[model samples]
Target: MKKYLGPILFFAVFEAVAVTLWLTMDHLFYLFNFTYIGGSVALGLVLYIRKWKYARLMVQLAVGLYMLIYLGILSRENMQIEGFWYYLFLGVFEAATIHYVVAKIAGPLLFGRGWCGYACWTAMILDLLPYKTPCGPRRKLGYIRYITFGISLLFVGGLFLLHVPDLEKVMFWSFFIGNALYYGVGIALACAFKDNRAFCKYICPITVFLKPASYFSLSRVKNDTEKCVSCGKCKTVCPMDVDMTDNARRRKNGTECILCLKCVEACPKHSLHI
Candidate 1:
C-alpha cells in the first residue's frame, strides 16, 4: 500500500479535475477523458514501481496513441501549440486551450516534464530510436525551440488575421501535417545528434511553457546527498542531461527533467529518487 500511495493520490487529483470539469463545463467527456488518461498514468507508475523495464514506454504509448489517433485524427482536434493558438485566437476555452493549460502549463508545476516523458506523441516515436542517451557533445541549438514556438504562433495568428476560409478544415489539416513534420524532424534529429531526445532538447515548442512551470515541480528527482558516492553514473544515463545529483531547483538543465528516473536506475550509490 505504501508503494502504491503516490499513484492513488495522483488518481484522486485527476479524478477531482475530471469531475470538476464535467460539472463546470457541462460535458461528461471530461470525466471519461481524464479518468482514462489518469488511469493509464497510474498503471504505468505501478508497473514502474514493480520494476517493469518498459513501464514508462508503455504509458507513453497508451496516452500518446490515444491523443494522436482518437483526439487528433478522429476528433480532428489539433492538440499542438498551433492548435492552442488557433483556439485562443477564437476565444474558445475548450479542447486545445484546455489541454495546453492542464498538461503543458499549470500541470508542469506538479509533474515537471512528465508530458515529455510519458505522454507526448512525438516523443513516443522518438524514444524508440537507437540512441537512448546522448553519445556526443550537446549542441547549442536550444534557441531553436523559441523560433519554433514563434512560428507556431505566427502560423495560427496569420491565418486568423487573414480570415482564412474553412478555418476548421485548415486546422484539421494542420494537425495532420504538423504531426508528420514533428515525427520526421524528431527522428532525424535523434539519429543526427545520437540522442533519443534531441528534438525535445532543441526544438519542442511546448517546452516554452513546460520549462518555467517545471522549474518549481513538486514531483522532481531529488538526491540524497548523505548516501551519494558521487560516481557520476546518473548524469551518464540521463536522456535530458539533467543534473539530478545537485538536488536544487536551479541545477543545470534542471527544468528539462522529464522525471524519467533513468538517473535513479543508474545511480550506483542509490542516492536518487523522484
Candidate 2:
C-alpha cells in the first residue's frame, strides 16, 4: 500500500486537471489528453515500484511519442517553447500555453523536473544515445541555455511584431523544424560531451522555467545520512550531476535533478529515496 501511494497520487493529480479542463474548456480532448498522460505516468510508477528496469523508458516513449506525433504533427499544435511564446503573446490560454503552465512551470513546484525524466520528447530521443552517465566534470557552458531561451523568445516575438500571415501553418512547420534541430544538436552535444543529457543541461531553454520552481520541489530525492556509508556510487550515476548526498534544497546542482532515480538505484546502502 505504501509503495502504491506515489502512482495513485500522481494519477489523482492529473485526473483533477483533466476534469477541471474538461468542464472549463467544454472540450473532451482535455479529459482524454490528461487521462492518457497521467495513466502512462502512473503505470510507469507502478512498474518502477515493481522493480521493472525499463519502466521509466516506457513512460518516456508512451508520453513523448503521443506529444511529438499526435499533438505536434497530426493535430498541428506546436507544444515547443516557441509555441508557448506564440500562444502567450496572443494572450490565449490554450495549447502550448496551458502545457507550459502545467508541465514546465507550476508543475515543477511539486514534481521537480519529472517531465525531463519521464516525458520530454527531446529527451526521449537523447536518452537513447550511448552516453548514459556523464564522463567529464560538468562544464560552465550552461549559459548556452539562456541564449537559446532568448532566441526562442525573439523568433516568436518577431513573428507577432511583423504580424505574419498564415500563422498556424508557420507554427506547425516551426514545430517540425524545431524538433529536428533539437534532435540534431542534442545528439551532437551528447557525442562531444560524452553525456546523454548535455543538451538538457546546456542547451534546453525549457530548463529556464523548470529550474526555478523545481528548486522548491516537494517531491525530490533525499539522502539518508544515517544509512549512507560515504559511498560515491550515487554521484557517479546521477545524470544531472546533482550532489545527492546533501539533503538541502540548495545542494550543488540541486535544481538540475530530473528525478530519474538513478542515484537511488546506484546506492548500495539504500541511502537515497524519492
Candidate 3:
C-alpha cells in the first residue's frame, strides 16, 4: 500500500483539481486574469527565501489548474473551427505565455522548474502512471533537451518562413491530436524502454526552455557529499532517471533534475540530503 500510495494520491489530487477547475471556469478566469496576484507574489517569496518545496507546490497547483482550464477541458469550447489560423495563434500564444513565460521564467528562475515536478498537468499525469522498472543505474542525458529545443525552433520558424496559413489549421488540429500522440508515445516508451520520463527529457518544449533558466535559480536541490553512503535509492526513484548518488558525490545538480525531491525523500543514510 505504501508503494502505491504516492501514485494514487497524485491521481486523486489531479482529478480533484481538474474537476474543480472544470466546474468553476468563470471563477478561475477571474482569479487567474484579474483578481489573483498570488502567483507573482509566490514567485517573489520563493526567490527571496529559497523555499523550493513550498514554491514548487504552489506553482504546480497553479499551472495544473491553468492547464486543466486551457488545454484539457475548456480548450474544447474555446477552439475555433472556422477561423483556424486565428485560433492557432491564440493557442500558441497561450502556450508560450504559460509554459515559456510563466513557468520557464518565473517558476524556474525562482524555484528551478519545480513546477515540472509539482504542477505541470502532463507531469502530474505521468507521475500517476504505473512503472515497471526497478529503480536502477540511472543516467543523465541533458543533451536531449537541446534536440527538443532545436525541433521547436524549427517548427515555429518553418511556419513563419513559409507564411503557411494552413499552418494554423494544421496546428489547430494538432492541439488535440498532438497531445494524444505525445501521451501515447510517452506511455509506449515508458513501458518499452523503461525510461520513466522519456517525453519530459526528450520532447517537452517547456522543459527545453526551463532547463537553461533553472541554472540561475536560487532554489535548487543541493547534495552533501561528505555525509557519504552511495546507495542508489535516489537514482532509482527519480522519474527523470538522474543519478542522485553521482550528483551528491560530485556536489552538483544534474541538468536533467526536475527538483522533485524524490531523491531527498528516498535517501536512507541521509547521505543524499538535498
The TM-scores of all predictions, comma-separated, are: 0.99, 0.99, 0.62
lDDT of 2 by residue, 1-274 (tens): 9889999999999999999999999999999999999999999999999999999999999999999999999999999999999899989999798899999999999999999999999999999988999999999999999999999999999998999999999999999999999999999999999999999999999999999999999999998999999879899988899998999999999999999998999999998998
Candidate 2 backbone clash number: 0
Q: Give lDDT: candidate 1, residue 96.
A: 88
Superposed by TM-score, candidate 1 places the C-alpha of residue 42 at a distance from the truth, in angstroms, of 0.3
* Lowest summed lDDT window (length 10), candidate 3: 77-86
lDDT, ranked from best to worst: 2, 1, 3
Clashes of each: 0, 0, 1
Off by over 4 Å in 1: none
Top-lDDT structure, candidate number: 2
Angstrom error at residue 196, model 1: 1.2
Give every collision pair in model 3: 60-119
**Cα-based RMSD of the predictions, in order?**
0.7, 0.6, 9.4
lDDT of each: 0.92, 0.95, 0.55
Estimate candidate 3's RMSD in Å. Answer: 9.4
Sort the candidates on TM-score, descending order: 2, 1, 3
What are the per-residue Cα lDDT tens digits for candidate 1 across 224-266? 9999998998999999988888987899999999988989898
Instruction: Tell me how candidate 3 scores on lDDT.
Output: 0.55
Q: Which stretches of candidate 3 lie over 4 Å from their true place?
A: 1-62, 71-95, 132-148, 166-170, 243-253, 269-274
